[model samples]
Target: MDKNNLTPVEKNKSPLILSIVVGIVLILFLAGGLAYAFSTNLITMPFNKAIELLVPEISATANPDSSSIVTITNPNSTGTIYYTIDGSDPLTNSLKYETPITINSTTTLKATVIDEKDNKSDISTQQFTIMEKTVEKAVETVVPENSSSIIIPEEYQGTWHSIKATGTYNFSGNTYTYSSGGNVHSGTIGKIEPYGNSSTILVFYPIEVNHGFTVDPGEKGDGMIKIDGTTYAVENSDVFD
Candidate 1:
């Protein structure tokens, strides 16, 4: 066709068609540029690295008697710590560590940490053994000649009340009677020795009854410490109470 020979409709459609083709080519050129940049490592995209959680730490302090105070700590300080005392593996639903655990006997403590991202850490474990203190018979004085009873020292004798438990302990001669919790436990004072400043260690041999203390008496006797000549505390019990 010759110039200025086209109709009015064709004249208007020419610019619109040319604009659409130009837009398509520009889009293709931009896409090719982006592909080349990525292929040549010119521009980089943002990346997120995986986060790791830290394991917890277990520590313990053994008391003079057969007991220990166990403490658990985490380095992150932002996550929750779960633990177990029965040597089992710890999980999220296990006992949440909030305070120091008091272990009276031998135990294996296990702990782990869980962060906000649900990342779990390796388990930390510690074993605590509460060894019983032994005293020889010849070192202490025995009473009643043939009987297997030890003399109750004058300071620890007589009726005394426990500051911790709602009980009364009566010591007379070589026998002792402990009354508490709607029951009475009578036994012989098997051993007595001097403890820390103004304190004494007393062991009771229960007579067909279990002593109401942390460690139940077996073949061995139940031990108690008289603190400062006023308060009586059992094994694993807090000091001076």
Candidate 2:
């Protein structure tokens, strides 16, 4: 075969060699670029988002029956909760949550949490209403059908007003009369029984007209009758004649 007229096999070999060189160079350039990116943290997109400490959450609620307790909580198990009243922000020096707090009136409560990794959570806040229990009583006329000289407590002799609505109760000599909601109710103290240390229940009876009135058995409490979970304030009338 003449050198000027290269054989088909030789020409093919030359082309294959050139292609291999080009591929190797391209691979080397790509490798260098990858190395540069890693050194400068440019390709660290995935690693930059490593798991981070989470912030804490807060919860709060009020006690419905009494103005004595309000509950506050941090659901995150990895952190401690701090709190403040007076509409102030809580700090590390704030009161640490250990037990339920007592709230007697309207108050602004704020709280914060700090995780184990020192990550601080957003401040949480709540407005708590400690409502005063308004005395509730029914309107009725006092008619003592049953007579017993069971002396009632001196404190029981008084005029009471309904805290929730327009009502009045006048008590004298084991008898109390009430008028409410265009209705009237009257009852005589049949029996006085001790409830708690400072509470007593006065069993009452209706006379004259029944009017389908109901004297709840659960109406026994401290100088007040508990009707429908409400306490009627019974006190000496400011305008007793």
| Best-fitting candidate, scored by TM-score | 1
Q: Which stretches of candidate 1 lie over 4 Å from their true place?
A: 1-50, 134-241
| Model 2 Cα lDDT, one tens digit per residue, 1-241 | 6767997898799889999999999999999999999889778768454334343444545556756575666666667888888898887888898888787778887887776556677887877776788875444334344765545555545666665657876668866687888888776655443332323333444344433222332443444554334445655423222
lDDT of candidate 1 at residue 32, scale 0 to 100:
99
lDDT of 1 by residue, 71-163 (tens): 898888578999998999998889999999889987888999987767788999888877866774435443433355446555445665566
Clash pairs detected, candidate 1: none
lDDT leader:
1
Candidate 1 has a TM-score of 0.39
Per-prediction TM-score to the true structure, in the order listed: 0.39, 0.33
Which runs of model 2 end up more than 4 angstroms from their true locations? 1-68, 133-241
